[model samples]
Target: MRARGLALKPYWSALQSSIVSGDDRMLFPPFGNFLVLPSVSPLYVPEDAKPSQEDLQAARGVIMSEAQAFAAEIRSAFVANLVEAHNGARTLDSPLEDVDKLMRLVTSAVPCPSGAYCSTSATFPAILDHFKVCSSAALTASSVSTSPMRVLAIQRVLAAVNEVEPGKVDAAKTLTAELYALGNEAFHCEACLPQQAAVGPAAWSNAHSTKMGWTKMVHHLLVRHTMLGQTLPTVIYTPLKPPSDSGDAAATAETASGGFVVEDAES
Candidate 1:
């Protein structure tokens, strides 16, 4: 029903504000280098739901583990930025993972407003809304930058990360299914439930891990592509490494050319 099939209500407030202002905020949300709180809310598990203590513990474990994974994403990005600064650029053997990490990092940091649908389900509308929020955030972030080029570059990077190209998104869709399915089976549904519709704590943990894994992979791929698109031109307007010596080298050059300057006795 929502435009583009994205139940966009979750971001209504934020998006409305962005549209009104033409989105002048920084927009990229600090490059998501560090994981923070999750923007997406966890599955709707009632505090009073009569699940066993073990199940509750399991759910809490999943949440905590995800938080940690999100944190790791930020840490990874910080390291990558450091290495990039020194070594110039290094592509990961697996970029999809990187994309997932970035998403986790970003989502964790900029907690989405409470109204947003917080599940991982491939609710096409919901997923679209997620991208809309991310994009708006990125644009808002970029607008304040004095450097327009940097802003545009960042926008492209964020866009690429959120893009969800056709055909490639099926895996993401599946991940959404697993997350929602797991949530339903473990915490939500009490009706039409299989007598044996139960998962061991170990098994549930594994599913969570797998979900996070694919999520990270996809997140990283977008990041890599975004990174690639943002590849700035090299040695163009920017000068190459300045001459090794720029001190009074002009004087030294003149001395060698005209033989007037005296060499240091120490030399």
Candidate 2:
């Protein structure tokens, strides 16, 4: 099932290849190195358990390292797929309007942090076109949205978690927003965001987060975004055009940042 879905994503192979094992830089304290990790609600940890100081520190390191691995993999994958899409554009009969849809379909197949936007209500034209659009959008004196910038897709997923589970969504939403903020700035802003700092607080330094917790959150977000038919589809999107001032590139100093499956230790 995983392999089948991954094939649809042009970049999944690279991202998954680099994720062979958690990078030791963020190595969490192994509860018991499972020859095979289990699948469950709180797969990484036993529910109601408190992490010891050693566990906290270890989890922080592991989560940070894993986050980096995920980010690198996503970047590589996106670049590869994007380049392919650009090349394919010349041969494919598809029109320019279909470009974002193609990118979304490819990205949806991967269970990475970068996939969050596939379900977004925002419209990101070709990122290469962002500066041009920003300039034009600003010139028209068109009013920008006052809504808080959040990952439109993950926001709904988080809201669902809040409804179904007793105490899960709020923290996830907070962390997700932080990640989104840092992520947007890094890619969209004129000044690149501080990926390390963005990921540190919610992931590295936070006491409540566990090695397994990081993994669980990532999986949950992906699964929630999947269609009931269990196949990728052309995403139906609502566009939230971003503000233009952010292109200045000077605001990348601060920001926020996790995981594939929840481990038993995370619960």
Candidate 3:
């Protein structure tokens, strides 16, 4: 089931290759190592519960079906947004200025005092990195007029942000929904224009505006959090495993950092 889920998208493969090669500096905190699941959700499985084979199979089927649907939606949204942005009269540039300002605010914000969980310190830096990457990829894609890389890049930023602080930025969530719907509608509607003519100026404009608004909302949240000196649950960071030693592989054991391993969470 895990293999099938990974096979649903090419981004996973690209990310894996990048991780293995150590080619991208921004690919921090490693991909598969970070597994986040909602603490309270219907998907939770009891540790002692023993499900029958039929029940397990049913769950697997449902999960796979949902994964397939999500993959399809992502592809559709990418194509729709790409076409509209590329063909529209105005250029689709990311809000780099806003991102830079946010980064500055984060840098100046007070660090978490001795034993508090600094949510801002944990999530904001990595998110800013993602924002820069997303902006660069979007610009490159726009120049080529053929890539859907921007969509995946933006999605990465959104997913990372959502993971750390879900529901904090309602505007971001709305933008994501709008993008998904725009693509789904384009795919299902017969009245939709042909590839070249499918560029909906109004649709693209609205999405662009929403994206900008979402960024500002995120910035505002960071400002507020910093001012209040708020903190979230502390997250313990585990160090990565060392490479296998041909002879004495047992000698290469992982060690705790500073006698205790605690670092900011990265997504």
Total clashing residue pairs per candidate? Answer: 29, 23, 0
In angstroms, give how far residue 201 of model 2 lies from its true place: 54
Residue 93, candidate 2: C-alpha displacement in angstroms: 18
lDDT of 1 by residue, 182-205 (tens): 121122111212322454345545
* Candidate 2 per-residue lDDT over residues 15-102, each given as its tens digit: 2234455332212111111101221112234445344445434444444454455334433455355446444423334544554343
TM-score order, best first, reads 2, 3, 1
Candidate 3 Cα outliers beyond 4 Å, as residue runs? 1-41, 45-54, 89-267
- Specify the highest-lDDT model's number: 2
lDDT of each: 0.28, 0.29, 0.28
Better of 2 and 3 by lDDT: 2
* TM-score (all chains, Cα) for each model: 0.19, 0.23, 0.21
Q: Write down the RMSD of candidate 3 (Cα, Å).
A: 22.9
Could you tell me which 10 consecutive residues in candidate 2 have the lowest summed lDDT? 139-148
Those runs of model 2 whose alpha carbons end farther than 4 Å from true positions after fitting are 1-44, 91-267
Q: Between candidates 1 and 2, which one is better according to TM-score? A: 2
Residue 253 displacement (Å), model 1? 52
* Candidate maximizing TM-score: 2
